[model samples]
Target chain A: MQGGVIALVAEAAGAEALGAARGLDGNAFVVTDLQIAYLALGRIGPVVTSARVLGTGPDGRAGAVVELRDAGAGDRLMTVVNVSGVPAAVLAGSTR
Target chain B: MTSDHPVDRRTHVSDYFRLERWELPSDGGDERPSSFGGRAPIDDHQRGAGGGLRTGGLLTNLDTLGGFTSGLAALPRWIVTTSLLATVSELDHVGPLRFRADVVRRGRSSVVTALDVVDEGAADRHVAAATMTCAILDPRAMVLDFARPFSLAMPPPQADPVRPEEFFCIEPGAGPVTRLRLADQLRNPWGILHGGAVAMLADEAACRAAAAHGADASGPNGLAAADAVLHYLRPVKVGPVEARCQVLGTRAGRTSVRVAIHDVGAEDRMVTLGSVTVLAV
Candidate 1:
């Protein structure tokens, strides 16, 4: 459950970062990739995620790396993820 | 092949994937650094319930090509993968996927590679993005020899190599634990358990643990693996590798799991750490 939540939050944060970087609405983007490294177990509740835009592809694809922490556990590091968001229209003809 | 390590006499995990290597030109016309890639057709046995290549199988291919790319960058020395991470955006891909990998950073002790897979049959649409990190190490007694612009072809077909689970003969040991013995065919060029084998073992352990923990309560549909993040801390040099898993939690038909792989013959030292997510089908 936490893994799914972490993925969702990272995607949202990555979309926002990319939207801000490219001057586009965040809602126009969708997460396309996510690669995470689990550093420590998060035993506490209310996990938080932070994102930083790395670069934007010429085709409007944006990449970012996100870090997740446990807010209830003294903000201890939990996971580091590399995520990418692309224009939602790109999936128009996708089979999956 | 070294007398102590007869890796060449046996088939490798890469042979099953059937990836055809290609010679790549220098990046940006620079001669010092270069990129390499290959292509492979998606096979029926490799598909999951979602009609796409399974994450574990895909990761195996990624590890193969990415390892070669990084190894080339660290010539005169060798590398053992430390971690592997990837996300597949498009699962239902057309045939013949192209894989490209290039060195991201080449340090004295570590090398990182950026890996990308695109559907060649779908106008090169993005399919997956991944990264591999390897620790640089001296090849001590091992020999290092390769023809520059290195290229290799898929080994001759061998009566249809079975799926990984079949090849490894994975069997459930006890609650939330799975075991597989180290067979010669399961070793990599380094004479160690192939990284892909490690991934398959971890994936199986997570699936079994998640299901036992109620992830399969959804009905006969059962659970399917969604993603995997593996950190290979050390190589397994001994036999009878074991994977122990624990379900962290489940919600909305999604289960999160953690797995620890240990070399049972090597004093039970942990060899790899993995986290997996499974979705109810």
Candidate 2:
């Protein structure tokens, strides 16, 4: 797999994970730095990813870790950690 | 922007950016060695079976295409890549692969270009994306200026270096060092070894080193690259460029590797440097 594609997936997963953690309905974060570790080849199907918030900065920047797995086989495909900038409103739980 | 005449093609906004296309052949035989040092026996398990274009192939194309786009943006001048980073989440090996690139940022002294490898059927879905940073250099400043030499810290050379034929089409060099004899197919439009090719060589070298370091103990498929950063220092115009890689470290299932590229005939003058990280998945 191309690293560029992996980065894009990681970026998307990061945003979703952050949004879910904050109980928001929409994503409003921008990725800054990303690190990914490919674990296995993803079979043809929907890729399942789970994200966890690692930490959050005072300036509304947060770090998260996400894991991507093959939906069909449930084999972990890759792990990604990234930092993103979030809107203050979303971080404060004021925006849905 | 100023125009000399009305209704002139040069004055059109579309004239600032140009689109180009290329076709790369697949079916290149796998020559990659099972591991470095040729100590491990080549087996089916070591050679995982799945045929498509290698990840390196896509990187090669991205480098060339991204560079081309940046050059077009440079216009009346030329630009050279300072660094390139590509992240691929998916793989597509089907033939007649098509992609498009656009100049995302045109600064006074630098140009940033982005490329997307789209699905042949669904044009909106991009399978892969890449970005390149190129430095716009003055034509008159193209002359080489030597910098003070410095020493590099590297591990001792391997006793039984892996052969080149087993990993790449390039000529075999000394132990732990792979060499690529410059050929027409390997050259970019500028008649030099393309940056993507350089990145491929570096990635191969780093991957081999990581594999040799026992990072593949996790499974038989070997370590999959997480990401890579390549910095082009000089152009490779001579034949038989050599690539040397060293395993920097392995921690938390992540292996860090560093690779250096040099011209064999030029007293091993460094031409490129790259760092790659892989997970022992």
Candidate 3:
């Protein structure tokens, strides 16, 4: 579940970043990597994640870091994730 | 906790963990290329006083299994672990955890492997889900030659392996600093200290640093490392690697720490950067 959340955050952030680039022709970004450190368990209702783009590589890969906090748990840090993504078309055997 | 388990003292981390690899079906091409599956025991050596597999132990398992899967995906070209991420949902685990690894992506310069672990003794309860990213590089002459559908036999367990702290010879230094010797037993196939070893050191450093920051072990909020994210920028080919930890801050009983691992023998160059979170257990 945490992994899926991370990928969703990474893909959303990467799409926004890649959407700004001119030459790519609207390609969807796929999460390439995600490194996460689980801090505490989320014993609350909703877990929120905020992401900041670390940087974008020359080869169209974008890196970002995400932090997940449990809102019901006094916004305590739940996990920290480092994620990267590349255009779906760039993946091997991708028809896109 | 007593180290009563007789230490066999293996040379390599893989041997110490008794990681055994088995072949996976070559279905699901790029997305799920049934890469590698294996299993290892989580005995007293790998467990903490809390009776759960330590955070470092969990990271080590992720690193080891993911490394093999990604390395094999890279084939003739070797690979180096650039990043490792794992979220462990379950803490108390039964012995002999099983691992399933698959290729998520095989790109031009990198390979990403996704791994899932389950407790074999606990009726295959989910233990962790992790991903490893490796930078594909020219192997030169250090390429691994393995037959198709490669399988490695589990080394006979003579006795319980030494704990990571003892195996790595980790000792506390001044303040939040921890020292790890780059002994041959800690090195990987590339003749460098394994990434798992680095993660273990970082985890240890984070816990110690949190303790230094008033995270009382006997307090209402006892501290232990819950999660760690490591980015391997360079390899440690020299000895006396130091993990210098700095407490980022504490929030709601959780402390964040940044650890910079440097190879003192290599002119104190930073080899890995780690972010660890210590939580009240």
Among these predicted structures, which one has the highest TM-score?
1
lDDT string, candidate 2, A12-69, tens digits: 8887766666665335665544644444566564777776564443345455656667
Worst-scoring 10-residue span by lDDT in model 2 chain B = B32-41
State the weakest 10-residue window (summed lDDT) of model 1 chain B. B1-10
Candidate 1 lDDT (Cα, whole model)? 0.74
Measured against the native two-chain assembly using Cα atoms, what DockQ does each of the candidate structures obtain, in the order listed?
0.09, 0.04, 0.06
- Cα lDDT for residue A52, candidate 1: 61
Ranking the candidates on TM-score from highest down gives 1, 3, 2
Ranking by lDDT: 1, 3, 2
* Tens digits of per-residue lDDT for model 1, A10-59: 77888887787777788877775578655556788588888766555455
How does candidate 1 fare on TM-score?
A: 0.74
In candidate 1 chain A, where is summed lDDT lowest over 10 consecutive residues? A87-96
Can you give the lDDT of residue B132 in candidate 1?
83
Indicate the docking level reached by candidate 2. Answer: incorrect
Best by lDDT: 1
TM-score of chain A of 3: 0.70
- Each candidate structure's TM-score, on Cα atoms with residue i matched to residue i, is 0.74, 0.53, 0.70
Best candidate, DockQ? 1
For candidate 2, the lDDT comes to: 0.54
- List, residue by residue over B105-163, the lDDT tens digit for candidate 1: 67789877777788898888766677788888887766777776778876655475566
Interface RMSD of 3: 16.8
Clashing pairs in 1: none
Tens digit of per-residue lDDT, candidate 2, span B60-95: 656655665565556556778877765543332333
